[model samples]
Target: MDASVIVAGAGPAGLMLAAELRIAGADVIVVERLPERTGESRGLGFTARTMEVFDQRGLLPRFGEVETSNVGHFGGLPVDFGVLEGAHQAAKTIPQSVTETILEQWAAELGADIRREHELLSLREDGEGVEIEVSTPEGRRTLRASYLVGCDGGRSTVRKAAGFDFPGTAATMEMYLADLRGVELEPRMIGETVPGGMVMVGPLPGGITRIIVCERGNPPQRRTEPPAFQEVADAWKRLTGIDISHAEPVWVSAFGDATRQVTEYRRGRVLLAGDAAHIHLPAGGQGMNTSIQDSVNLGWKLGAVVRGTAPETLLDTYHGERHPVGRRLLMNTRAQGLLFLSGEEMQPLREVFSELIRYEEVSRHLAAMVSGLEIHYDVGSGTHPLLGLRMPRLELSADGRRTSSTELLHRGRGVLLDLEDNAVLRRRAAGWTDRIEVVTAAPAGAAPGGPLEGTAAVLVRPDGHVAWAAPGSHHDLPTALERWFGPAR
Candidate 1:
């Protein structure tokens, strides 16, 4: 158990995978190029699914309890999460630095060895495992692990060395972003559209506020020269018609989002997640959220495989489940880019959708799209309603216990759900002891004395997702166990 998994890159994806692996009792090591955590915030927000994952892990509260969330719509207008059918429907505004910090600290608490200023130079993989080479201050050193994860982001050395093809269209527009201090921009009322351009502003924890501006033109998509800082502010002034002569500029950079995705996410013992696996525009702020979600999807499965609780075929599902998700993110971001960056010709279309967002159903749909809540896997069949859906928060009142699905997951074990405890189903689920937790709920959506007809013995995964379910004990529970949890090891 020297190195069960070696995670490259200490960004959100790597740190999250390290945290999950450590929690699953795996000897994990994290490698990053940065010497210390960057105080500058990267991405601007987190979706509901991301928050649910954090909440389920009991780490959300440790994020300093910042409750600044936008329950409205993206671009502009209003939306509703209650009407959405997916796992997470809301988007929470939190910076990348905060998320990475929380995950880094949590992984450290779980005793994950995090190496900084050390870049992976090479990796050799065979049927046995992976042999990784890294360049450190002292010199070069090699480490062996059962598996290696490349969360190293785009331009991933791991993906390149593995000879994976990242094929897709890069962003058509080049954008400039800067963090401003002493600015008069309204943080909450950010992301505005003007006649000639679009401005996205986000006020961070401190007085620093983020400003993103993109011109609607056919300018060269790539920037080789250092961006003119004054021009950026001037563009903001011209777009928003606001004077910010007194604002102090902090950090500035220019980047274009290339909507590229690798055809294969895994090759033998090496795995890719986040930007390493897929690249898309940050127009909707989906990059960080998507990457963290990718790690969440892969982490538990990898752990299951390492523990001999899952078949080798289980690893293949990582690509099957996530590749489509990456494609969807790219498509959605591209559509958003067209709407936000289009010229006068597209204004009518944007106006139509903008008006349509007023409807709860439409708003919820877009919210689900922007927040990463609309994902539902065709895992098996339409037999059970809870299968492949997120384990929703429910109330409990058994043994004077009152809690939610989030609280029950703190122990980090799967739960066997007996909603209302229907007699036939209860008798059928009597044998699933150690592998599945049994929780009887009442029909009133309470703890006990409820009917479990439509849903029976819902099995939640280690990552708070429904893995397997039986509407009745009539279905062979033993087979389901063998297929999902690998025959009790």
Candidate 2:
């Protein structure tokens, strides 16, 4: 394919999308501004939802080695995401560097030209594609791509050059952070008493502890702004009752919880994603997780458009589906701040949750919110069972071997399960051998290992969402195929 996608940031979102596009047979180029990996790692963990997306592509084991989990909650309260109503059951704590490294490696394997120390200086969209101006070590050069994506953090030069408006409020409250050594703090345990203001200390995999100090009236500071290490250390001791007076500092920075989202995530042929698209408080470890998922959600649609198999409207769905998710992300993070900031005066609210914890539903919902597994869309397909729902990662049986639904998608193709091998079902996938892979799932209840009930012959999209499915149907198959696979064979 002569057409190429120029991705402006090498962060998780950009890298993930680049990998997806390359895997789908597109020429992809990823650009990063940093000359080298920053020893200072931010976005220290990913929710189970993010891990599930990776696991589907056989990318989990690559990242899981450096990851730690069994982490229970935020602030001082306990979290139980395993009870959330979905396939993703656990959260994994991994450094942003490791996450970026895994994605970079994956993209490289797919033959994406990932260039570092090359910053996006300017860009213009024409009828043919987008022409991006870059400033590299070799001086400046212009590159053309059929599409351009800005994953270049909150301050994206691509978005700015394209004249997109990022509308949102700046932070009013500020928090300081310090990654220190010689500090002894349990990774999972955080104080439940951090009302109005709170401090949290958690273990990052490398024996390094992360300390976050937030206060109600503290002045907001840019992330680049440095805070006094001793002051943060003293405050940590006061809040957690742990003295880390002699801990050697690794990295210290301050930031605000102020949140803002772009009014529109896309501007013409160039799109904004990840931190480049939306940023909010660091609450709930969502900052990075949401961005990675955004590209996953859009990657396939972009690929299909480039491949000439999907309508132009498909690309628009990236903004349609993702913008609302971004809105929810902003709101969810704000609510998390309240929980972390609740003081003695807010004791009643805690008492309510503590009391409500007995009811499994409330805890399950909150857990779902944090994990981001609870997201569902408006099903624009004129009403279908699986239209707006995520596919349940289930184990299925084939000619003899046991396999997970994710296994089939590792090669990045759509799957059509034929439950009974019904003649009509067999004929439904007659054409498009190049686009869809057909597989016959075992008879109804006989599927293997953790199969969700009421699923028979599922149609999995390239991005892993369930495009069309049937609980029990021999005749409804054709209609499902048309809407999802774009007027099937």
lDDT of 2 at 3: 47
Model 2, residue 43: distance off in Å is 1.9
User: TM-score for each prediction?
Assistant: 0.89, 0.90
lDDT of 1: 0.74
Which stretches of model 1 miss by more than 4 angstroms? 68-70, 74-93, 186-191, 218-228, 237-246, 398-400, 419-436, 440-454, 472-475
Candidate 1, RMSD to the unseen true structure: 3.3
Q: List per-prediction Cα lDDT, in the order shown.
A: 0.74, 0.74
What candidate 2 gets wrong by more than 4 Å, as runs, is 1-3, 64-71, 74-76, 185-188, 191-196, 222-231, 234-245, 380-387, 443-456, 471-484, 487-489
Tens-digit lDDT track for model 2 on 78-164? 766556644565555577778888888889988989889988888878877898888899999888888899988887888788888
- Measured by TM-score, how close is model 2 to the native structure? 0.90
